[model samples]
Target: MKISIFGLGYVGCVSLACLAENGHNVTGVDVVPHKIDLINKGKATIIEKDIDEILLANWEKGNISATSNYKEAVLNTEISIICVGTPSDVNGHLNLNAIYQTAEQIGAALKEKDGFHIAIIRSTVLPGTNEKIGNIIAEHSGKKRNEGFAVVSNPEFLREGSAVKDYYNPPVTVIGTDSDFASQKISEMYEGINAPIKKTNIEIAELIKYVNNSFHALKVSFANEVGNICKKMNIDSHELMDLFCMDTQLNLSPYYLKPGFAFGGSCLPKDLKAFKTMAHDFYLESPVLNSILDSNESQKNQALNLILNKKSKKVGILGLSFKKGTDDLRYSPVVELAESLLGKGFSVSIYDRNVNISKISGTNKAYIDKHIPHLSELISDDLKKVIEDSETIIISHNVPEFKDVNLRFSNKHFIDLVKVKDIVPSANYEGICW
Candidate 1:
């Protein structure tokens, strides 16, 4: 396969060398004469592990070359990968001038091209960028999208220090495009790489890098804060973190990664508060740790707003416990939500088979009595009665009895906090965080 890469910076340089090593004739384009000259002279533009050898070997093999002529590069290649930089502006927003300029140049070059071309955006960009690029190319080339050409969002996952290794051993190869031909071509280009090829919506492909990097930043901050507290306490932070990482069941795993309602159970809230208090007592500021509670409260507020936005006076809560298959009501978010709804003058009805208010005792009983004094009036074991009486139903947890309530009660609007099923039944269904 023949390919042209725009922007001979870190990502472009590594991509050019790696793609050529993968048996593709690659041409690198850059505005800077120095970068172009360096690549043409069998020298790498960026210094990193194995890049010099790979670039020199590929350049000597006549598999790779560099040029400043965008028209020549686009016309000679079957696909063009945009590796342009999307740096931050003064306001911290993405400066996309390079990406847009590259798109315009590719579109102009496509004007005289005879066959279909695929433009792959390997740059880190936000959502909706692919559509804008497609439109720009279509307007400039006077050709319809997916007919004369296609734009695919194939974001690179290369880290700078280990760029060459990361390129060859990417976690996943993502191809976001509407064209099957373009997807197949991109997938085939990465045929030698050992990674799962994931096909997804274009926006997801575009936004994933931001999500990944933000989480990475969060992880680093969290670790540093923990390290600060540990160091002050004369404890080995490394040993603590090593032990923490060994717990694959919860820590370093996807246990609580799902987007859903705010956490309100016995252990999470209590432990988090304790940890934050420990940090506070040590005269240490743990912003990331402290922000968790605020974020959780915001999520609770979000659920409340969703329910109130329905404008229905009668709201039925399908599950009252913190989670499904539990009788525990202490620190339950549903309990708090129900209390809020009742306080707001909404006719609230709850049905949780696990929770029997009269039979409830201990902290759980005390919790309900203090929160909702008139629990006997609002709570019921009859799911059918709750569904039949309310205009809007809130499915707080995924209980077996509430699985197909949407299908059964077509007239009632359902606000699913916990996704009741894989597929929703009605047009009136709303997920709290889909």
Candidate 2:
């Protein structure tokens, strides 16, 4: 396959060398004449382990070259990979000037060239960027995407130091775009790589990089916090962590790893309170530990604020339990927030996919029912009826029906306390955060 990669930065240089080494005719494109000269001279523009050998070998073998001509590269390739850098703006938002400019250049090249070429974005961008880029290209080229050409988002998960190995062995290969031709073309690029290929929408593809990075940052912060606390207490943090990691049952499994209702249980809530109390008693300023409760409380307040802003008497609450697939309401923040709304005189209707008012026989069930009188009366078994009769709907869980909420309750207003969708703010929509 003849492939043209735009931008000779870290991502582009490594990708060009690696793909060319695998027998693809790869051309590295960049505005920088020095980078192009470096690549054309059988040398890598950037430094990476084994990249010099790969770039030099590929260029010497006539499998790779670099040029500053976008038209020449596009005319000579079947696929164009956009690996431009999306640096952050002063306001912390992504600056897509490079990407948009590259898209325009590629579009112009596509217009001049008369072949169906697949455009793949390997840059880290925000959601909806792929579609925006696709639209820009199509409008500029005067050709329909998925018909005359294809556009896709295949985000790179390459680390800086070990990018070659990471590229060949990524955790997963996420391809965005519904076109089968686009998927096939992109998947063929990674045919030799040992990784699961995940097909999703453009937005999810864009967000996967950020989500992975943020989780890694969170893990680092959590480990540092644990180490700091252990240092103050004269305990071996590494030993404690080694022991903690050995408990693979709950520690390593998919527990407490979802974005949904506030975390509440006998153990988590009680232990958090105890930790905060211990910090206060020891006069240790443990803001990280204290912030767990503060963030949870703020989320609950956000849910309450969503309910209050409705200005309607009848508000439907979906998923009464703190989480779905469970009836344990002990320390459930949603239960407390619901009561606060009731105290303010809002008629609330509740529906839970897993919660059964009549079948709940445990002490937990009895306690929750007693605390919130008329629980069974306000609960509805039908989800559609709940949305139909209510003025405002507050989605607190990722229930099965909640996926269809956009189409189901398209007429009614929604205050989504959870980030259910990529962009939920429509005419009658209000996501917690977009």
Candidate 3:
């Protein structure tokens, strides 16, 4: 397939050389004369591992070339990959001038094109960027989107040191577009690559890079803070981290990664507080560790806001325990939420199959007695009664009994704290975070 890459920067240069190596006729396009001249002379624009060999080999094979002419490049190529830089502005917002400018140039070039063209955004951009690019291209080209052309968000995952290797060996090949033709073409372009091809919505494709980088940054900061505290205690931070990484079930895996309600079980809250307090006692500032509690509180507030926004007098909580199967109510977010609602003068009813208020004893019993003294009055085992009595029902647990409650009580508004699968669609249905 014939492809043209805009912006002969790191991403573009690597993409041009790698795509050419993948048996695609790739043209490197840029505004800078030096970049174009370097590519034309069989030299890589960016200095990276194996890029020189890849560029020279591809250029010598007549499979790669560089040009500043957007019109010619667009006309000659079936697909145009936008690898323009989206640097930060003064306010730290994305400076998308290069991306928009490239879109305009592609749009103008597409004015005279005859066949279907695929404009792939390989740049790291925010959500809605692909939609904006599509609009710009449509406006400039005088053609309708998904008819004359389609804009696909195919973000790059290449690191500077191992760009060429990363190009050929990405974790997955993401093709974010609405058009089937464009998706198929992009998938075919990565046919030889040994990775799963994920075809998804354009916005997800656009936002995934930011999410990945942000999490990576968070991990680094968290590790550094842990290291700082460990050094103070005369412990091997590297060995500790290595052991931490070995626990794939919880630590290194996607156990608690889902977007949902704030964590409020006894262990997480108590342990986190103890961890932060330990750092505080050491006179070490662990902002990342400290921010965890703040972020968790924010999520709880978010859930509270979502429930209160419904403006319902009677609110039913489907689960009262910290978790689904367990009868534990200590530090349960639902318990906190229920207390808040009752305190705010909103009528609240809770149904927990696991929790029997009379059977409660010890600290768990005392905890509820202090937080919600009228626990027995508000709590019930009858799910049907709770559903019928309430205007808004909050599903806090993923119990099998609550799965079809949405379908049963179609009239009641449901605020899902735990994302319940197979929910029957309704105007009343809403996920807390999703």
Candidate 4:
């Protein structure tokens, strides 16, 4: 397969070496003449682990070369991977100048084209960016997406300095496209790579990368803050964290990893309170750790505010479980939110795929039912009826067919707690916090 990679920076250079090593004929394209010259002369431009060897080997084998002309790269290659950079602007939004310009150039080259050429995006971008680029290309080339040529988002997860290893041993390869042709083409490019291929919607794939990086950032901040507090108290933070991580049964494990309700179990909520109490008892100002519960409560309050702002006499909720796949209602913030709304003037109806009325004979049911006694009567098993009845839909979880609900309830508006779509609604759509 002949492949053209735009931009010879870290991502582009690593991709060129890896693809070339995988037996694909790759032409590296970049604006800088030095980068192109370096790749063509069998010298790697980027400083990555094992990349120099791979680039030199592939270049010597006549499988890889570099060129400065975008026209030449696009016209010759069967697949074009847009590995351009999307750096942050002054406002921290994704600056896609390079991406837009590259798309236009690719479209110009495809103007006199006749074959199936797929434009794959390997740059980190917000959701809907690839769709926008595809539209731009389509407008210029007079070609339809997934027909004349396809556009897909294949975001790279390579960390710098170890990119060569990360490329071949990635945690996951997320290819965002609905077209089978586009998916197959991208998948074949990584034929020998050992990684799980996650085929999903473009927006979900885009958000996954952001979510992963942002969570990692959060963990770093948390650890540092804990270390800072431990230092203030003349304690070894590393020792504390080391001991904390050893308990995989509850802590440092997948115990709180699921996408469920807002963390209201017996141990979590209570222990968090206990930590704050202990900190205060010890005269330690632990605002960073203490604020976690407060911030969580604020999120729940935001949901409650959205529901209350609807001003509807009767409001219907699609799911009652804290999450989609769980029945544990302990400290499920949604349950508490529902209880709060019921206390107010608004009448609330609830639905859960996993929860039922007869299954409520246990202690959990008794605890929840004690607060809202009309629970059995308000629970509905059917979703169609829920959509038909609710004035405003508030999607709490990523329940199946929620995307399909947008078309069904055209009249009803949505207060999306989860960022479901790429382009958020202006008039009828409101995200909890985009």
Candidate 5:
């Protein structure tokens, strides 16, 4: 297979060498004459671990070359990977001039070429970039998308120092393209890499890199904040973090990473407030820690707004507790949401088989009594009765009994926070964040 890479920077350099090493004839393309000259001379444009050796070896085998001619590069290669820079401005908006220019150059070059071409966006870009690139190519080359050529959002997840290794050992190779032809070609290109090939929606593939990097940034900031508190208390921060990393069940695993309603339960809300307040008491300013409660409150308000915007007189809460299969209502976010709806003068009904006002005691009983004094009147054990009486139903948990309530009650509007099922947002059903 023949491939052309658009930029000669870190990502492009590593991709060129690694792909060439995998027996693909990889051409390094750039507008800068010096960068192209360096690659053509069997020298890597950027300095990194093992890149110089890999590039030199591949060049000696005649599997790689560099050129400044974008037209020739696109015409000769089957796949053109766009590795251009998407630097941000002062306002944080991406300056996609390089990406767009490369698209135009590839489109114009494809005008004189025959056969199908695949353009892989290896650059980090926002959603809808793939569509824009496809439209640009269609307009410039007088050819239709997914027919004459196709665009794939194959975002690179290569870290700077370990790029060559990262390319070979990524967690997954996500190819976001609608065309089967392009997806197959791009998958074949990465066949030797040790990762599963996940073909996904184009926009999802485009935006996942941003999501990953942003989470990475959040992790660093959170660890630093924890380290600050540990230092203040004379605790071993490194040891604490090492122990924190070992918890695969909750701490270091995918337990609460989904996009859903506000987090509640007895522990998270109470301990987070206590921890951030303790940081304040120690004369330490933890912005990340402080901002968490505000974010949680905002999510609560988001749920409230979704219910109230429906403008229904009667509202039904499918699950009253913070989560499923639990009777603990102390500081439950759903309890807070129900209280807010009642305050807004809406008729509210609560249904939770696990929650029994008779069995409730101590802090749990006290919590519910203060929030909903008339719980016995509104609460019911019968699911059908609660759902049938209400005009708007808010499903809070992902229980099997609640997942298909809309299929049974076709007239009632459902606001799902747990993504109970794949629903088409009609008058009868809607998801909170899906």
Candidate 6:
């Protein structure tokens, strides 16, 4: 594969050398004369481990070169990678000036180039950026997208100290493109790397880097807060965190990491409140912990607003419990949503296969009686009847029956709090946060 990478900066320099080391003929392009001069002289543009040696060795083998002529580089190579910096501005927004400039230059070069060309965006950018780049290229080159050329979003996952190693050994290689030809070519370019190739849409690939970095920042701040509380209690925070990390079932797993409706189970609500109160009693400021409940409340209201905004007077809830296949109505978010709908003068009907009003006893009865006095009147065991009587339906559980409810009834509006796998987004169906 012959490749041209724009912006001979940190990521560009390492990628050029490493790809060349992987047997791909690479050309480094830049506007800076000194950076181009250094690369042409068989010297790396950045200070990193093993990059200088790799670049020098690849240069000696004639697999690597540098040039400031973007037109010539694009005409020679089959693929072009945009690795220009997307630094922050005064208002904390990304200034994509360099990225647009590089895109324009590549588009101009592609004007005279023949055959299909693939341009990969290796910089961290927000969603919808790939579409904008594709549009820019189409406008400049006087060709349609995916007709003569394609734009791909393939973000880099390289750390500063281990950039060379990280390039070869990443957790996963993400390729986001609409063109099948581009996806195949990009996959072939990374054929030797020992990592799973995750092929997705362009927007998802573009937004993943921001999501990863934001979660990493949250983890660091959360750990610091826990350490602060542990110090005040004279406990070993490191040991406690090590033990916490060992729990692969829930704590350190993907158990609760999903975008959905508010969490309203018995253990979670009770324990989260307990932790927040404990920190408050100790005079500890745990913003992250304290904000959890507020965020959950906001999610509940968001679901409520989505239903209310539909302007339907009749609403149906598919599941009444906190989870599926369970009769536990204790702290169920769907139950609260039903109660709110009733309060708003909207007729509400509910269907739960597992929830039997006549059989429920103890705290479950007490909770329902206090929150919704006319529970028996609103509850129905027949699934089709509940869906038929309501104008809008809320599917909170990802059950098999709820999956095709949207498909079967195309006229009724469907609000999905849980992203049911089989449910497709259409005019009558909408997910809460997806």
Clash tally, candidates in order: 0, 0, 0, 1, 0, 0
Cα lDDT, all candidates:
0.93, 0.83, 0.92, 0.82, 0.92, 0.92
Candidate 2 or 4, higher TM-score? 2
After superposing candidate 1, which stretches have Cα over 4 Å from the reference? none
Candidate 6: tens digits of C-alpha lDDT, residues 156-264 = 9999889999999998999999999999999999988878999999989999999989988889989988898888889999999999999999988899898998999
- Pairs that collide in candidate 6 are none
lDDT of 3: 0.92
Candidate with better TM-score, 2 vs 5: 5
Report lDDT (Cα) of residue 149, candidate 3. Answer: 97
TM for candidate 4 is 0.76
Give the clashing residue pairs of candidate 1, or none. none
- Candidate 5 lDDT tens digits, 311-345: 88899999999899999998889999999988989
| Residue 100's lDDT in candidate 4 | 97
Alpha-carbon RMSD to native, per candidate: 1.0, 5.0, 1.0, 6.4, 1.2, 1.9
For model 6, how many clashes? 0
Candidate 6's error at 131, in angstroms?
A: 2.0
Candidate 4: stretches off by over 4 Å = 247-254, 274-288, 309-339, 346-434
